[model samples]
Target: MSDSTSDFLAADAHAQRRYAPLTRVIFRLLLAGLSGFLLCVPWLSASLYWVGWFAWVPLLFALRDTRPWAALLLGWVAGTLCSAGGSYWLAEFMVNLKQVRPLLSTLLALLFWCYLGLVIGLGCLLYRWWVRRLGGWDLLAFPVAMVSVMALYPMLFKTHFADGQVDFLPALQAIDLTGAPGLDAVMMLFSVLIYRLLTPRRSPAAAYSRLAQGTAWALLALWLGYGYINLYEWDRRMQQWDTRRVGLVQPNDAITLGIPEPATGFTRESPPEMLATERLVAAGAQWVAWPEARYKGYFDDYSVRDSYARAITRHGVPLIFHDVERRWVDAQRISFNTVALLDEQGELAAQYRKMLRMPFGEYLPEPWSWPLLKGLTDLVFGEFLRPLGAGSEHIAFDLNGMRVVPKVCYEAAFPGFVAEAIHTDGAGKMLLFLSQDNWFGETSQPFHHGNMSILRGVENRVPMAHLINNGPSLVTAPNGRRLASSEAFNRAELLADVPFSEQAGGSFYSRHPQLFLNLIYGLAGMLILLAGWRGRSRVRRRGRRCSRKTRPTGN
Candidate 1:
């Protein structure tokens, strides 16, 4: 061949190689963005249930070849987009409110996105290391690893509720006893399996043939399993309590944080407390439940006491209203994450304070603690540091001969807290969930938050009487069927004839909390350790060879 011909071909090859780097970078960025979009899609108000699983595919691709810095940048952008889009409902409500400066509220939303990005980015890095050592058959690791990161990611945030699973009913049902962390793990594992099925194989024809066969079998197995399990557990639990008529009060008032609380969704001068109570009584509710912080301000004191007394005289049924904590001199500044219980006469019966606090959104536990200098924390994290002291003990109230265990706001998402509360009350207890779903607005937050109760209902084998400040006030039977629920994003109430059942004697979680968490941590730790050890050994071996080569000084 001529020299000119060889030179021309070599130049062309070099040029092609140069574009490879840029092409790879562009591909990673696009994949990252797409993954972000898919994650947010499942959170839309009208999203189909199956759409949530689409997120795992692009995420798995991101895990495979994404660069470290790209992992951060891409994850940050995606996290922000997903979080903002999914929970944009919060901003819609906040935009019209006068209490918080609009600019600050918007800033808070961005802050949430950035915070979640950091956690996910960390997960990506961890996965990169873990996957390098996984066995050939470890296809399941893709989903399991991603989900584990998602589940535990909330713990790093100031609020555990941030980890709450949204809209994944089957996943949440698994959480009733498995808890949020476990459910997250299971979802991620399944996601990897589904992604694998959808991915095209090296040979398209072979891949299609295998996938077709596997898919049919998988569908058949899932159908029979779901049906059999549902049927088997159906009649196992029998309701023991006498039926009670419960009225849920939904006042459509948009609450302005710093102002005097209003009763209806719109502005009204008189307190809606007494009026709402009278309406519920007139409606013939054996029991009435008000959403979280319905009255607001100074609830545990004398003025509030007199107010309830007057309301009770007019209403014959028992009342459950959320009380705002009175901030007084050194009163520990313990604001009530409270659910107030009152008898037919308005006499104070019992109360349950919220157990789980939203991270960064709720309180900043240790702001000064830093792992590495570059690891950034959220600014809004410490802003609302209203860490109400944890509720000291569990309390139950008896109403119309029924024992009721109460949970306030985010407490329903924490399986451990619910199980403990149920155990305190023993069998045949009705679980009453009082929540301010308004904080989450019309996003998946409220729906996901509300659905969590269904799992608790099934796990404890007790009926749930749920009252939300906004929408999705739901009633779930002991078997986890939704008996009644509010139309989304509206102020409404439901009267449900709940059939109570004895608390199930054994729960998978109750018998094994430490075992599960430890096993997960242990596995994660081992993977991390193995990766670190391999990296260190390589460094040491290289160092030894270099040392031997430079040993001329010993001669």
Candidate 2:
């Protein structure tokens, strides 16, 4: 009886020991998912953005003993979860705003999530490959590889939610050097540090080395110092110029095409748009702005044109509005999505058309040219989408003696586009982002848009005014501060004193963006190739040694 009891106890102990590794793996996977969710969305609270700094630490530890293929799979799970969690609003928007079916919208969301998730999975695969090849020096290689992979990853799967990934402004000051991709590098570095602190190393070789810690710390210090200096320089520059009072006229009106509501879509501009602009100018606005695509057919419609002239003539202020112009040259019809600025004399001073159009939203891609895709879109949207041509030139409006760069809607998300515009006037530039965020409803997408768009001002040392429909017109200063923001989904106006810096240099980013990214790409590529070659050479030498040892001593 005693022997049987002992046997049973021994078997139970063995089983527990066998299942321990699996249990650890499960726990680590959960950690990775949680960490990924927190890092990319800051779903808990905006203030808890610090969680992103080391969110990938658990995943790094989890991948310690994983094969390259296994790492890819694990990464897919984590990345998919991360993408889905971050963009949960996309599904809601499709259903509520775009009127897509719930199931179909969810499936669309899933497809996009998986596509973006591949970047993370491939990064994991590459990480495993390097860890195998570099062995002890992997800590040194990690950040470099991570930065390159992340920088390239988003090009394949572009989404501008990078703000939630790293919210450290001192670190973000380095954006002029590496753009937002630099934040991903810092996040990877932090993950490595966290892993070193928490994970125990059983061998001297397995010990986490402080190889990149100096580079990381040096970078942080440099960024902070640069940020301080940049702000100081901007302040010095600001003192040289007079402030302009820019007014944002947000008419909180629901858009219903073919259905005339109080202040919606080119309805003689009476209920809100004209009223708001008039009030703002009366209150001492030098330039008043409106949101995107507010009027469907501006130039062709006499009433809309008359309304625009009436407002400018009465207010005696430059009024900016979302407009379109149709040109029929050589029997080819073309439409321009434009922001038209009317001078105080009630005449069109300048117009900036949208160059970068959204795929499917503004224009459909080649896939949608396929019959299947066309059919799908037709079914969902009730018709094939109108294809909008790209604008060739970057046009700026001269408002109240200041060069105002206009970014229509999602164009603000493109940093280079905005940078080019900031550099257009040579110096002393202000910015306006005419956006209609109504389609997103009350989702976190507006927050994402705000986070992504505000960074442009920081990069170029320019002040930005966002005149968004469905509310939340605001300004972001050069110091990365958001001010004078109106409430979302409300008919409100933001009149703020906006200042422009007379600094001649657009920014370091403008002068040499290609250099920074090229260096990163070249370094990352060489390291990978060199490590892989060394690994192969070591294998060859080991094989030769094994053959020699097995020669039987020539007996």
Candidate 3:
């Protein structure tokens, strides 16, 4: 061959080699992204389930061959997509509220995505790091490290996956003995194991085949075991107080009542709510639940309370009204959402102010950010607000022979909070959830909220009655079985006979929460540090040996 031609060919070969690695990296990233998007579908479902968590296995496997930073970036992308897709409900709420510009809302959406993706990527990175140190140990340690961090990271950020719905009950139950942190560890570890098994570099065909077969069997066993256990629990614990007719008055009132955008504002003077309650009571509702913030006007007044009392006193039926407490701040007063329980005589029985106030839309932690926050709050026309102080106590009231516990609004998401309410009141019977979901009418908010109640029901082994102002009013059996649900955006009442039982067999998690999940991760974290130290020592010893071997002392 001519010299020029030979040189051309050689240059071409070098160029191809240089770009090949980048091409492969891109391919792997694309694969990971596709896998992540698909997996996120379930997590972002109307119910916000984690059914697709299994897809992480394929993505993690694809990431293993890449550089550490590349793995992190890819994981981040996947995580972002997942979070954005899963939590698009909040983004949609922002859009409806018209608070922030669409561009800013999109940016915020992506920011949440990135944050969650970072957790996913960090999990992959931790798995890789542990794999590098202990080699084969990545099968267990890597998953443990990644899941532990991912699970805890959400808690630290105050947006834990525990609050999400769809299969969380099963997921939590699967990890009940281990706790969520440990369950996270187990999930990640299993993914890594699958990844390692699938990768040709890590395993031979026969071993891969064997491992795959074993995995299928193990998974099948788990499914059957879970199905049986769920059934067993249902039969044993799913009893409720017999035939106590509940009158759930779903007054589909505008959520932005006092805020803005011309809601059909109602006060105690609004006869419709009173009429509806009377209708529900006449239809055999012994206890009537009004929607969240059911009052026509600001309800922090005695006269309003007296009027409400008189109305219900005439019916001789207990009424639960979700009211708001608004105090003027600057030109506008901030409003707090609250649920007030009343006796048949209309006397205030118990009240709970909402906790877990919405972020960005609610009060900013810093006073300086009020203007920025107000700009955002203007979407819903709500006054940028301050959080109501946590309720001093949980209300456990005895109606007839049943002891019932009530949770207000989003308080159902926090298991500890709900448990505290149930146990502290010394009244562990049935569960009552009073919420106002009129803000995001017919959106995924109500469904997502309903899913949280499912988890609460299963976790506490208590039958729950979910009463909402607008949307998805339903009752769940102790085993997380849905009995009946009211439609969204309907002005109506529902009647369900909830049976109450005194049997209190605490689940595994109820007995020892932090110990099963948190402590194990703490120990695993310590172990990773220990493994890293050992790895460093080994590297140093090898370096010293190499240096001596190549020394010029003999020459």
The candidate that wins on lDDT is 2
At residue 294, give the lDDT of candidate 1.
Answer: 45
User: Compared with the true structure, what per-residue lDDT tens digits does model 3 show for residues 214-276?
Assistant: 664476458437745874566565443355777777767665523432234545554466778
- What TM value does model 2 have? 0.91
Q: After superposition, how far is residue 32 of candidate 2 from its true place, in Å?
A: 1.7
**Candidate order, lDDT descending:** 2, 3, 1
Query: After aligning candidate 1 to the native by TM-score, how far in Å is the CA of 411 from where it should be?
Result: 3.3
Global lDDT of model 3: 0.63
lDDT of 1 by residue, 73-142 (tens): 6666665666666566655544433235668778765775677766666666666655554322234344
State residue 69's C-alpha deviation in candidate 3, in Å.
2.6
* Model 1 residue 513 CA deviation in Å: 4.1
Better of 2 and 3 by lDDT: 2
Best by TM-score: 2
Off by over 4 Å in 3: 1-12, 46-53, 96-98, 154-190, 193-197, 201-227, 236-243, 257-267, 301-303, 326-336, 366-387, 423-427, 552-555
lDDT of 2 by residue, 9-50 (tens): 999999999999899779768866875675565632446667
lDDT of 1: 0.60
Which 10 successive residues of model 2 have the least lDDT summed? 257-266
